[model samples]
Target: MIQRVIQFWRAINAHLSGSDFDFINIYLNKKEQNLFFAMRLYDQRHVLNVAYTARRLAQKDGGSINEKLLMKACLLHDVGRTAEDIFLFDKVFAVLLDKYLPKTAHKLAKYNNSRNRSFWKKRRHALFIYYHHAAIGAEKLQKIKLYDIAEIIKYHHAPPKYGDCRELIILRKADSLN
Candidate 1:
């Protein structure tokens, strides 16, 4: 609960303070920039943290990893969370539903496809994305021809099958650290 509150406060602060995109300009291409900016400010800040952490981890790991791809994966890993403009209460509810009533949460999330829904309906949809953002982000990345990055994003929250993906492991660790 305390962690969640801290995360919420940090997200609100990040949204209010606007990120300095200049720092990451050299790392991302035009298309990537557009996608990154399309996300809500809270998510954008989170992505920046994740990317920075991933890069640092890579450098500390002896420079064997492709730092660029790792950073890209980190930047886009939570892109799916941008599917809706979620508020703090919605996020808390989503977490609770995901933890205790997962099936119901999934059902509610899948039910609303129209953007013209009521506030509560939209909240449900956002909750669904929160739980399944990894796969959704992977699909988005795949559409942009970033197959390797997409694979890492897809399995960031879960263990990969082959279990030998060093980049995925590093990304997961970095994500958790931030």
Candidate 2:
């Protein structure tokens, strides 16, 4: 644990030099991230940064503006990385998860779309996000009911229909760049 802490601190310090340390400090305190997790978080932060950027760019391009869904998809795209103990396994499990249960995943992605919206309303988007976290986050999210948030996670990687969801496009552009 100590080694993990040291590793995490050094890695984050290197990767996130310009980050909002206030937010990072609070996040570290709240999540108690080990060094490994912290490092992973740095990577995720970059990914999300790109995703949100693309989202903004997409808005400029006349696509629908949905910051809530973009945030959900961008942030949670990598939450699943926590599942893999090995680097190669991460890709493998992700592929399998998508293949075995696409509808659930897509629905979960939509749920993620509603997370921010639900904050102001009663309609939660938990179920959508939950479906993709392999039953764990899904159940918890379902309990909390952030269907949009869950759906964002589920479908952010592969949104429903072929033409591409605006949020998914932004997320993909961000994922590619980040």
Candidate 3:
């Protein structure tokens, strides 16, 4: 509950600081930056926070993680959820719906576009993006030849299975916190 409040607060006030912009430029190349910037400002801010948290978590892992790859993975984790797919209200609605009524949320989370202007279609699209952003992001990364990073993003929201990589673990932890 408190985490949702924090997330809501952060979403409303999301913006990029100068240093955040610099950090993004340093870690992402031109193509990567395009993908990152394609998201809404709120998501950009969230990813920046996740990247910092991931680096801090990696530091405590005794140098076993690849910081660069972790940072890149964190920054581009939500590239699948672009500004076009969701808005501020839609994000809030998706979160609340998924939290209090997951069954309904699932019902609305299918990918369909036959009735693009229908009320249900709008809600469905938002929920779809909410639930499937990780896989969508992975496909985008793969298209850009970022297969290694794509694998990490693909399972960022998945439950732990055997033999998860150090980077994926760190990314997921950081993502959950922010």
**52-122: candidate 2 lDDT, tens digit per residue:** 57666777778566775565445545554342222322333333445786665454443333223643121
Which candidate gets the maximum lDDT versus the true structure?
A: 3
Per-residue lDDT of 105 in model 3: 93
lDDT of 1: 0.77
Model 3 clash tally, residue pairs = 0
User: What is the Å distance of residue 9 in model 3 from its true position?
Assistant: 1.0
Instruction: Give the per-residue Cα lDDT of candidate 2 at 80.
Output: 42
Candidate number with greatest TM-score: 3
The models' CA-based lDDT, in order, is: 0.77, 0.47, 0.91
Residues 1-178 of candidate 3 have per-residue lDDT tens digits of 8998888899999989999989998999999999999999999999999999999888888858888899999999999898988887888899899889999898878775554557767778979999999999999999999999999999999998999999999999999989
Model 3: worst 10 consecutive residues (lDDT sum): 111-120
**lDDT of candidate 1 over 1-178, digit per residue (tens):** 6767777787788842334466557577887777777788877888888888888888888847877777778887887666254655677789788789988888788546687978787887777777787898788888889899888888899964676477888888888876
1 against 3, candidate with superior TM-score: 3
